[model samples]
Every structure is written in structure tokens, then in C-alpha cells.
Target: MYTIHFETLGCKLNQIETESIARFCADAGFGVTMAHSTASQAETAPVLSIVNTCTVTAKAEQKARRIIRMLLAKFPFSAVLVTGCYAQVEKAQIEQIDSRIVVVPGTAKDTLADFPQFFMDLLTKAGAPKTAEEAAALAKDLRAWQPLRQIPAEQTENRLKPNSKDTKAIESINKFRLATDSFMHHSRGSIKIQDGCSNRCAYCRICIARGESVSLAPAEVLKRVRDIESGGQTEVVLTGVNLTLYRGTLQTESGERKMDFADLLEYLLENTDTISFRISSLYPERVDDALCRIIAHKRVRPHFHLSVQSGSNAILKAMHRPYTAETVVAAVENLRKAKDNPFIACDIIAGFPGETDKDFEQTQELCRKCRFTYIHAFPFSPRPGTEAYTMKNQIPQRIAGERVKWLSDFACKSKTEYAKSFEGKTLKAVVEKRETNIGKAVTENFLHIYIEENKQTLKDLAGKEVSVLIKQALDISGKDEETEATAVLVCDGA
Candidate 1:
């Protein structure tokens, strides 16, 4: 089987989409591998490589470009397919990188499911291009084939129509069921229930790249959840660009009902048994009482991450965020009230245009008031076409870095304290890493705990939600990377 390697950069939504495409390829009889160190690999190089790009930060896009360049240089014979937010915004720049590259923007990511067939057809057509000239010609042809652009109506319609071959292909792809099934990349299953963001924040280009908000239908989401449960994946994360903005329709016994994110969660809880759900992230303004009530469900994991950009209303208003600092505090309060000691986290941009010293201090004060267990602090990087890009009084890079460091340190302290709270308590955890002697699992409240494997093979516990007794917490904070908030634990009854 031809090997296809995937590298994903960005959020859980991007990872879900990549896994979906990987499953499709695997179903099409292609060897799917997720790897980051392709340049150092000693095994046979893959015939094709797909890098799912992220445009969240300038650093993310830089890394994508670097990875793509490395992939092209190391595996000359492999053709590269780049897709996702970064590709959507900088298609021309990425396309100019190499002739072997094919750019598919984030908007057409759903079309990625049909890529395996495209790759198969390309291989069949090439039939072993032995010479450099033959390979170059093949690459040119591959680059010319824009999968999402300007397809003939008849061909598109015929492809969409139900047929024996089409049915078989769909079955094969869906056979994988859960996005993480037999996949080496992720331990927990992921379902992309929503995509694209409608909120046009001043500092964000994701809205431009992803376009308007769109959500998966409620029935389809429930079906995906059922599939994950049947596959023995006890923990599944519901991912999206803006999860709080999710809106869909569900056919109820009485009639068709419009459902929001909270309703969707409640529906899944009512329909499925034993499967725990995790919400990727939320907007502070949208965290209503209904959402908090649904979050109180036992099956729903007590971990929530919010996209709270800044704690200062001044900076927030400048960024065009709908919620105020007080809104975040209320949301956190509601969440805590709903679930005891829920692992509340938020994203914080330390420096934005026109942010005064008082504004920065307000952000720090908010973090202290909210007592977030985790804080994703980013030094604001101006992006082209963003309102903040041209906004005056841009914070200096040095000052921004310092603010980020302060938040990072605070986050480390908060996370370690939170982990300490769980010490000696037995909690349900989904196994994430299973080696020969040691296994790692994440608790419902998002603590990463490592346990010794005795009498049972660690591999057998992979993807299983097993009981673990937390022994102690460890602070593994770093400068470049966020602290993992890991702890050492013992398996229950071990």
C-alpha cells in the first residue's frame, strides 16, 4: 500500500479534520502515518505528505512553511498537499514554495475526504515516473488539478450520486468510525461538530480564512458520538472553530427543533451511554445558564476552555470581543457552580494595540480573580488585513514577551495548585499513553497522570477510561512550552 504521512498544526478542529482525511486514506487501502520528524526517519519515505496548516499565529504559519520545506527537501519523490487556515490565507506563498505542492484552503477542507481517490488516480496515471523529467511533469499535473476549484457540474453531480463504488468508498471511510480509531496521532476521539467563525475580532484572521460559522446537524453529531462509543473510545472531544456559535437542527419526537451547543450536548448525553464528552472551547458571552446546566451532567467532562482574549474591557473593546471582563468572571462562576472544581481555562493575548499599563494590570487581576487552571498566553502578533494590524500604539515585542511570561508563570502556579487538589482522590481517566511499564491518562478535570503498569499490559489500557489514584502533582513548567500539568498516579487496586 502507498504510504501517506500527515502533519497537523493548530487546534483540535484541525486535528479532527486531518484525522478524518487520514481515515479516508486508510479506508482507501493507503498506509496512513502521522509523523513530525520525517527528515530523520530511516524507514521508506511516504509517497505523499499532507500538512494541515494553522494560521492562528505568525509563528504557527512560519512552522508550517518550515515543515513543508523540510518535507519537500527530504522526500523529493513525495508530493505535498497543504490545506487549512494558513493555506487559505497564504496559498500563493505556499504554492510558490515548490512545484510538488498542492494548496487546498480551509474553506474546502470537507473535500479532503475525496483526496485518497485523487492520489490513487495520480499514481495510476504516473505508473512509476522513473526519471526526474517524468517526476517534474507529474508534479506539474498534480499542482494543476485544483480539487475544489472549477469542477464540471456533471462530474461533480455524478460523483455525489449514490452508486455501488461510491457506496463502497463511503462505507470504507466510515468503517474507521471514530476519528482516533487505530490512529497513532491522538489517544482520545474527536468530532468536528462546527467550523468557521463569524466573530470578526480585530486581531484574528481565522474568520477571514474559515469564513462564516457552520455546524454539523444534530443527528449526524449523535451518530458520530454513537460510533465513537461503539469503537470503545470512552472520551471524545467535540471540536470546532467557535464551539459556542454552533447552531443546528434536530428532529425530535414532536417536531424539528433548533439546537444550540448546549442543546446538542444535552441531546448526546440523553442518547448515548458511558461515553464522556469534552468541549473544545467556549466564548464567555455565550456561556448561559442552560449551557452551565448541561455541563453539570456527569458524563460531560469537567474541563472547559474559553476564548477570553483579554481581561481588560478597554483592550477587549478595541479587539471587538463581544464579552467584557465581568462576563468572563460570571461564566467562570457559573461553570464552577455547575461542577465542583471544574478545570476552567482561557486564552489570553497579553499585548494588543493601544493596550495601556492599566489594561495589562486588569488582565492580570482578572486571571487572579477567575483563578483559571490553565492560561494560553500569546504575545499579540499583527496579521495582514486584520484591523489591529494598522491600529496605533502597538505594544513593543519586549514588553509583550514580558507580559506573556508573567501570565505563563501565573498559569503554572494555578495549574499545579489545581492538580494538588486532586491528590489522593480516585478519578476516571482516559488512557492516552501506554508504554511497556508506564501508562499516562488524563483525568476528567484535565490533569495528566502517569501510572505504573503491573499485572496488566499498558497497551491493553489504551483508550480505556480506567480509575486512577493520584499520588502527587508535579510542576513541569518551561519557557517555550506550556506546562502539561502532569501528576504521578497509581492504578486503582494495583
Candidate 2:
């Protein structure tokens, strides 16, 4: 059997997409293996290797290129296919790195459901390989073949032109079809409810790479949830480029009704009984009262992550983020009022063009006032096509690095304080993994809990939600300081 090795990088959304592609490949009769799996262990080289890349930061893109080079070196005979934001934005550059590499842009990546057939057709065109020996010979020849340069006529046309009116209708119908297989084997599964983003943040290349926002149909979402449940997944994470922008129209027996993100949550809560849900990051301004009320539900995890780039209104305006510092404060207040002690996380950009020391101080003040449980501090990295790249008053790299260190240190301290507040309290947690003497779980408010228990006890609790008393919050941040601090959870009867 032909095997395909897959490597994925970037956000949870990228993970979701990679899972779908894996499922598609499996359905097409390819044996799927993790990228780290050795070819010697598999006893044969994979026919194809896929890398789903990310380009959120310069470091991320560098990592992707490094992985591509490593994969090429290890799997010399395998056809390397690259897709994702990096491929979408830097196709020419990636192609130059390895002319044999097949770079598929994000816009056409979804059409990878048709990739298996495409590959088979390519092999057939190169002399119709009918026997096993012929197939192996064809595969060897593919090492030198330039598939990307000689894409089929129909496939090339489809990528170039817009879909016809009839094709759009058919695509809309197909969008609601659910995949029979689960995306991930873990208890927590993520379904991408929305794709793309409309927000034109001055420093972001994601909008240009992902295109406009489009919400998945509610019916398809519910169907996928049921499918996941059937596949033994207990928790689900609804992810999107901009999750709050999810909008779909529902048709009931009575009449047609519109459903926003809030409506979708309520619908899922009212419909699905066994599964719990966690929402991905949302914009601060979109966290409305209605959405907050729905989030207060017991089945919904009380973790709210906001894309609050900076605390200073001046910096926010420069970044082109719509919300103000006041708006962020109000949003946090609203969530806190709706649910007690909800875990609030914020993304902060330390250095931006035209940002001053006073502006950074404003950010610190806002973080202090908001009392965020976790903070993702990133130093600004200018992308080539973004407006911020050309803007004046850019902070020096050394100064930006210092600011990031300061913000990150504060974030760790704040997280420790937040974890300390839950000490000695009983919280419900879902066991993520079970080991011989310890089990890892996460609480509703997104606290990582490590339980001390025997192998069988931990196994029994795996993939199930159970109550645990928080004994002590540990600072497990020694070598991997970037990792979160985990709390020690004592099993009630163990």
C-alpha cells in the first residue's frame, strides 16, 4: 500500500485542516503516517510527504522551510507537497528552495480532496503503470518529474477561473456534508466552523493569505459534532480565523432564521448533550452580552481569549485593530460578570511602529486592570507587504526584545497568581492523557491539572470528566519556560 507522511505547523486551525487532509488521503486508500515516523520502521519509503505550513511570524516561516529541507533530505524519493499560509503568500520563494516541491496555495488547498486522483492520473500519463513493478518504477521516475509545472489542463483552469453559478450551488450543498472519520484520535477534537478573516490589521498577512471569512453551515457543524461524538471524542473546540464572525442562516419548519455565533452556541448546547465545547480566540469588541450569556453554560468552557494587540489606543489605532483599551476593559468586565473567575487570555504585541514608552506603560496598566490569567507576548516582526513594515518610528530590535521579556515575565507572574487562586478548590476536569503514575487534564476555565494516580485509575478516568481537588499549583517551567504552569490535582478517591 502507498503511504503518505504528514507534517503540520501553526495554529489549531492548521491542525484541523491537516486532519481533514489526512482523512481524505486515507479514504483514497493511502496509509497515513506522522512526519516523525521513521521510514526504516515503516519498512518502506512513503510515496508522498505533505507539509502544512504557517507564516504568522518570520520565525514560523523559517521553521517551515527548515522542515521542508529536512524532509527532502530524509525522504529523497517522496514527492514533497507544501500548502498553507506560507505557500499561499510565498509560493515563488518556496518553489525556488526546491523546484521539485509542489506548492499549493491556501485557496486551492481544500481541493486537495481531489489530490489522490490527480496523483494517480499523473502516474498514468507517464506511461500507464498497471503492475506493481510498473508502479514502483513510475514512483522512482517521479523523483525527477516536475508535476507542478505540468499540472493537468482542467486542474489549471479550475485554479485560475472563478467557479460557475452552478458550481457554486453544488459547492454550497457539499459544504454541509460531514466526514465519517474523526480528525484527531485525542479526546478533544477541533472543527473549523469558519475560514478566512476580513479584519485588515496593518501588520497581518493572514487576510491576504486566507481571503474573506465564510462560516460553515450550522447543519454541517452539528453533523460533524455527532460524527466526532460517535468516534469517541468527548470535547470539541470550535475554531476559526475570526470565530466571532461566524454567521449562518437556518431553516426550521416554521420559517428561515438567522444564526450568529451566539445562536450557534445556544443551538449546540440545546442539541448536543454528551459533548463539551471550547471556543477559539475572539475579538474583544465581539464579546457581546448575548454571547457571554451563552458562554456561561455549564457545558461551555469558561476560557475567553481575546486578540488584544496592544493596550494603548494610539498603538491600537496604528495597528488598525478596531477595539480601544476601554473596549477591552469593558469586554473583560462583561465576561467576568457573566461567569465567575473565567480564564481570560490576551495577545499583546510589545513593539510596534510609533509606540513609545508611555504607550507600553499603558499596556501594562491595562493588563494589570484586566487581571488576565495568561498573556501571549510577541515582539513585532514586520512582513514585507504589510503597511507597518514601511511605517516610520520602528522600535529597535534590542528594545523590542527587552519589552517582550518584560511583558512575558509579567504574564508568567499573573498566571501563577491566577492558578494560586484555585488552590484547595474542587474543579471538574477532563483527563487528556494517562500515564503510569500521573494523568494530565484541563479544567473548564482552561487550567492544566496534573493528577497523581496509578495506571489503571488514570486509564479509567481517561477521556472522561471528573472532579478533582486542586492541591498545589506547581511551577513546572524550568527548561521549557514558555510552557504554562500546571496545577497538581488530587484524585478524590485515589
Candidate 3:
């Protein structure tokens, strides 16, 4: 029986992927050491390791390599496996220096009832399962004994995947029930409602890798939420390749559509008091009046992550992003009309193919005009197999990197200025993470507030939504703004 350590880097999607990977390993009969259950939760040991990485930027790639080195140093004789977008596109470079690390581009596609068997197969190309007594005995023992171990206060499933037995990992989680996470780690968990994307935005390889979009039905989604509720989750987040694309019905042959995202939201609001739901990122073009109205529901978190790839109209057309900048502005305005000053997050890519000084200025102007609190600024990275990969006059790497820095810094400044408006004002918030009374929570306005230190009681606030005033903006590095007062909790978001 081999033990494994799971590490994931970047994005909510990456977090979901790591969970799926762990589930796969647990199901395959290999015992998942209860050590690092969540991506942020880490323990130093467990020689066998897997790094689910990200390569959205050069920095992310460097961090992936750093983690790989750190893991190798910790587990000298351990089998190491690397997977995710970074490995998928940069396989040659990844293997060149860390040949000792087994690289699998699309790990989710590979079935290893457990991580150990995958490792065993890495040792030998066959991922064949074991009905053999030695392996069976170990699997059986691990299963029987797992429940007795002191799992952390917050593990969704105390007993993880039943000994692999060649079953698909995460299928169970995706099926009847989801693991319950204890602690205040997102009481409303993100459920991957769909996987993969079809639109290949020139500078992205995600579409090519994840393939066409496929969505999970509402029934299945409801079942999973019910499971999470049974396990102690209070809310469920509807996440997807593109959340707006959940197209499924009760009966396929009848050609009758059961429900779309809007319908799903109405159903969840009506049927389950045990659940509060939030939809993940949505494309600006995907938002219709129906969807926007559903988002206006009081129960839904007033947060919309609109993808505004570029502000330049020419750049948008060249990048093949569906929405125009004007359309994006209109969507933002429409949401504001529905849910006043709702926390709108957006993605901005700088230095795309054919991007000129005028185009960059357009992006800057959009940033100034758009009222987004959370701005994810990224410089375009040309990925392999993408149309922009071969496109000439590619934004110089250094220039792209500079753009990323400038945009990100500017975003932080803008976000801080936006957040400053809420200082001392009462706003509903949910306690997300905590260390005593000193913890972090998100106001419905979608502001991240750090609970003031020294004098507070966090005892009643765990997973509870309380009223908070926007105190002061903590700089990206955690330094506090002088004019800002401390965050004080007043009571729930809904």
C-alpha cells in the first residue's frame, strides 16, 4: 500500500481538478494519506507525490518547477508524477530537466483506480488492476482502517475512494454524493457542472486540450448538492467549462429540455433551503435577460465573472472572442441595473496578436471605465496548437510580461479604490476562512475583508454570514492602508 501527497497550483478549476485526481487515487484502492486533503492544506511528508500544475504564465511555470524540485528533495526515492496544462504544453522542457518526474498531459483521461497503481504503471506501462492477494490485502486493510484514523476536523469524506478496483475516480463524487469538507473551507463548494470548452480563444490551448464542452444534468447536480448537504455543506457553487452552457433534459429521446442554467437556478431556489448556490465564470455573450434575471435572485451570490478578453474591438475580433467590447459594457450595466454595484470580476488579456499601442490604450480605457472589483489581468501567452502560436509579430515575452505586471498593478489600485467606498459601511459577509476571530470573509459585494484583530469572537461566525464594514484595503502583499479602519462584523449574506 503506497501513500500519496497531492498538490495543486492556481485557479478554482485547478482546485477542482486536484480533488478529482485525489478521488481517482482513493478509489483505486491506494490509501490517500489524510495529510493534505485540500490544495491549501499541506503537510511536509508522504514521499509519493503528484503535482497538478498550471501554466497560465511563466511565473506559474516557474512555480511548478519549484514545487517539483521541492517534492523531489523531500521524497528522494519517491515516484513523482506531473500533470495539468503546464505538462500538457511544455512536456519537452518539463522532461528535459526533471526527467525523473513522470509527465502525463491529460491525467483525467487516464484511469488508475488509485494513485499507487498509476505509479506502479509508471514503473511498468500497464495500468492493470490487482485482484492479487498482496495488493488486495493492503487495499482491504486500508479501507477497513481509514475510518478509524483521525481525519482533520474538515474532510468531506473521512473514508475516501474504496480500493481502486479499476473504477473511475471522482465518478462517485460526480454521481450520488460529494465529500463533505469540514472547517470553513467554502461551505458552498464549487461543483464542476461542466467540463471542457469548444471556443479556442487564439492564445489559449485549453479548448484543444479539454475538447468540446459537455455539461452535467441538473438532476445529477442536485444529487451532488444533496450529498454535500448531507455531508454538512450549506451551499453549492455551479462551476463549468462555461457555466452558461448546461444544456440537458430529463428525457433525451422525447427531445424535451428539462432545464437550462436559468431553470436550474429557479429550481434550486424553490426546492432546497439546505442549499445556497453560486454560478462560476460566465462569458459576457452568454448572459441573456433570462439568465441575468435569475442572477438577480436574492439567494444567488451577486458575483459575475465576465470574460472581457480585450477592450480593443479589433483585438476582440482577431482573438475570436464572441462578445464585442460595447456588448460587454452593456452586460455589466445590465447587471448593475439588476443587482446594484454587484461584484463583477473580469479577465483582461494584454498584448494579444495584432494588439497595437492603440489597442492597449483601448484596454486601459476599458479598465478605467469598467467597474470591476476583482480584475484578473493576464498577458497573452502564445500556446502550442493555437492559431496565434504561428501568428507573427508575437508580443515579445518581456513585453507581455510587462503588460501583465502593469495591468495587475493597475487592477490592484483600482480594486483598492473601489473597496475604499465601503469603509465603515455595513455589508453582509460570509466567513470563509478563519484563525480564531482573525480570519477572512467575503462580503456579498464580493469584497474580501480581513476581520480585525485583538478584539473579536469568531466562534459564531464559522460558515456563518455576518455583517461587516469595508475596513481598509490590504495591499496585494497584506500591508494595511493607513486611512482605513479595521473590519468589524455586524451578523449573514442572505
Candidate 4:
């Protein structure tokens, strides 16, 4: 039996795929360990290694390459399987390292056969082939590239929409990564609802890579949620490509009418006490009152994240985003007025092709006005095969970097203010873990609290909700002083 270890670097969708692979390997009788790498372990070295690599940016590609080279050395005797996005995009480059390294793309990542046995057999047939230098030039460019085989997301329309299918599934799975997965810890895992994108944003490669959107059936969804809750996961988060796009995979009561995302949210909220339900990022085009009203329920945490790539209307339109400044503002206004301790976050992309200083400034203004709790900022990088790759008016790296920094700083400032707003306000914050990495607790609104990890007053509070007086807001430096008013959690929600 082979000992195996896996490292996933990228989006949530990749993490789910990695988890499924882990489940697969374990079921195949492989011993699993959570160690950082496959090659070295206190008990024994793994005979196999898998690097679920990401290649969203040039930096990501470099990182993947570097990690692959390092791991390939660590497991000289082990078979290394390179898979995921980087594997899909940089197939030739990965194969150049060693024929021994089996590179599989995202499409093939799923539907893989008993890879361990297949790998063992391949290695046996190839023989040890001795010497790292000799093995380094190993090439497996013997077969022709597979013809483009497109699989439509759950529902198949007899029509084509670019690489819509793939993008949808990819986005569907990504919910696990970017969404609030930490809340569902130690119980049932969250289920991915849909996948792919057809928005064809000029600056995003997601549309090309993930494919078109499709959703799971209401029955399957209910079944999975029940299974997760029964198995002990107290919460479930619904995620996917334009999650609002989730309709259904199978026929249901409302005619062959599949259950939409809003329906599912209502069902979960009404039917189960599965601890909590978190609504991950839903594109602006999909946000609606039905969903909003359900979210306003006292049981539902006052939280929702928007998929806004650019705040400026011109930049947003250029990026092919579906919503505008007013839409995002309206959503925030609704949530703030309805829910308690709500945290609003968004995805902001800076330095797109043709983006002007004025355009970016408008985005800045939008961010300030919205007062988002957090913003994930990314500098535009051209992705081959995407619409944005060849667009004109590209921003320089330095300029893009600067914009990204400014946006990130702005979000952080907003987060600080958000936390301060809760000062003297009572909110339910569950004590998750007290890792030395950081002080730990997540508020109902999803603010990560790192207070004194002291054993009784603090450490003793793990998994318990206390009446926390938000006290003074922590600074960017994370230092605490007497001038800082301390937080006090009084009543236990339990």
C-alpha cells in the first residue's frame, strides 16, 4: 500500500476536486496523511505525490513549476501526478520535466481510473530507468491531443456558447474555496451546486476554463444536505458558477421545473436546523428579493458577498460584468438595513485593458461609498484564449499593482470601520480554534476575531458564543494597548 499526500493551491473548486481525489485514493486502500508534502513523513515516505496546481496568473504558473520541481526531487522513487489548471494550461511545459510525471488536465482530473494501479503498471513497464538526469528528459508526447469534447453543464441545450460548460462547473466548485467554508468545519462538507460561466468577462479566464453554468437537482441537493447534517456537519454553504444560475439537474414537482437557488435556500431554512446556511458570492445579475428576504431571516447570518469585479460602470461594462454601481449599492443598502452585523465583500479587479485613471478613481469612489467589509483585489493578467487577452489599453504591471494595493487597502480600511461599527454592539461569535497562527473566532457576520488566547477567559470559549463588546478596533499592526477598549462576550447563545 502506498502512503499518499496532496497539496492544493488555488480556488475552492480545486479544493473540492482535491478532496474527491483524496476520497478516491483512500477508498483505493492508500493510507492518507495531512503532511505538507508526499515525500517525507515521520512514519514513512509516500510512494505517490499529487500537486493540484493553479495557473491563474504568471506568478501562479511560476509557483506551480517551482513546487513541481521541488516535489519531483523529494519523491525520487514516487510517481508524481501533476493535475488541475496549470496541468491543463502548461501541459507541454510540465511534461518536459519528466515523462515520469503524469500530467492530467482539469477535464480529465475527474473520470480518472484507478490512477494508483495505472501509475504502478506504467512505472513497472517503463522500468526504474535509473539516474535523475536521465529521467529528467523523459517525454511522453506519444499521443495526439484529444479533440475538443464539450460537456454541457447539468442541462444540455442543443446550442453552443463558447467554452460555457467547463467554466460553469469550475465556478460551481470554486464556491468551496472563496466562500465561507470555515463555518461548516468539523461537520458535513458544503455541496457545490453549479458550474461554469457564460458572462465572457474580458479580463477573466474563468469563462474559458470553467465553462457554462449548470445546477444540481433539488432532490439531490436535499439528499446531500440531509446526509451532511445527519453525518454531523452543522452548516451547508451553496456555491457555484453564478450560483443564482442553479436551476436543477432533475425533474421536480413544479412541472419538470427544477428548483432554483432561491427555492433551495428557502427549503433549507424552513426544513432543517442544520446549524446554519451561508449564501456565498452570487453575481449581481442573480441577486433578487426572494433570496434577500430569505437571508433577512433571523436564523440566517446577515451576510452575503457580491461578485463585482470593477466598481466603475465603464470598467464593469468593459469587463463584461452584469451589474453596475447602483445595483451593488442597492444590495448593500438592503442588507445593512435588514441584517445585524452584516459583512459585505466583493471581488475587485484592477488594471484591465483600456482602464483609465479616471475609471479606476470611479471604482475607488464606489468602494468608499459602499463601505464593503472586505474586497479581494486582483491585477489583470492576460489569459490566453480569453477575450481579454488581446484587448487594447492594457495597464502596466506597476500601475496595476498599485491599483490593486490601493483597492486592498481601501477594503481593509472598510473592514476596520465595519468592526468598529459593532463596538458596544452585541453579536454571536463562535470560538472556532486558537491556533498559534492567529487569534481565532468568527463572528456571526464572519469577522475573524483574534483575541487573547488565554486558557480560561479565552481558550475556554472555543465553540461558545459570548456577549462580545466590540471594544476598540484593532489596528493594521494588530497590537493591543490600554487605550484599546477590550471586547467582552457576556451571554452564551447556547
Off by over 4 Å in 4: 35-44, 112-188, 249-254, 423-439, 451-473, 477-494
Candidate 4: residue 342 lDDT (0-100)? 81
TM-score of each: 0.89, 0.84, 0.77, 0.79
Candidate 4 per-residue C-alpha lDDT over 69-109 given as tens digits, one digit per residue, 9 for 90 to 100: 76777756555667776776566678788655766655456
Candidate with better lDDT, 3 vs 4? 4
Model 2, C-alpha of 5: deviation from truth (Å): 2.2
CA lDDT of each candidate?
Answer: 0.77, 0.74, 0.62, 0.63
- For residues 1-51, could you state the per-residue lDDT of candidate 2 as single tens digits? 677788888987877778788887788777887545442343456677789
Expressed as tens digits, the lDDT of each residue in 1-494 for candidate 1 is 78888899999878877878898898887888775655677766677789999988999999999999888778787778888778776777887887778777666666667667876888877664554355456667765666655433322111212111111111111212224444456778888787767776888877666666778889998888898888878888998888888999988799999999988999999999888899889999888899888889898899999999898998899888998999999999999999999999999998898888899999999999999998999999887757777788989999999999999889988888998888778788877642432467778888876765542555666666777777778775764433333443345322
Q: Write model 3 residue lDDT over 1-494, tens digit each, in one string.
A: 55577777766766665665566666655555423333344554453577877766667889888888776655555545677667655655765654346555542323323344435444345332232333333333332333213222212111112221121112212221223233222434667777656665666655544445666777777666677666655556777667666776654476766777788777667766655676678888767788788778777777778888888999998887888888888888878877867778889887787788888888878777876766788777665556776787777767777777777777677677767777768877666543432466666666767776332456445666677767676565234432222477554333
Per-residue error (Å), model 1, residue 162:
44
Write the candidate numbers in order of decreasing lDDT.
1, 2, 4, 3
- Candidate 3's TM-score reads 0.77
Model 2: which residue pairs collide?
A: none
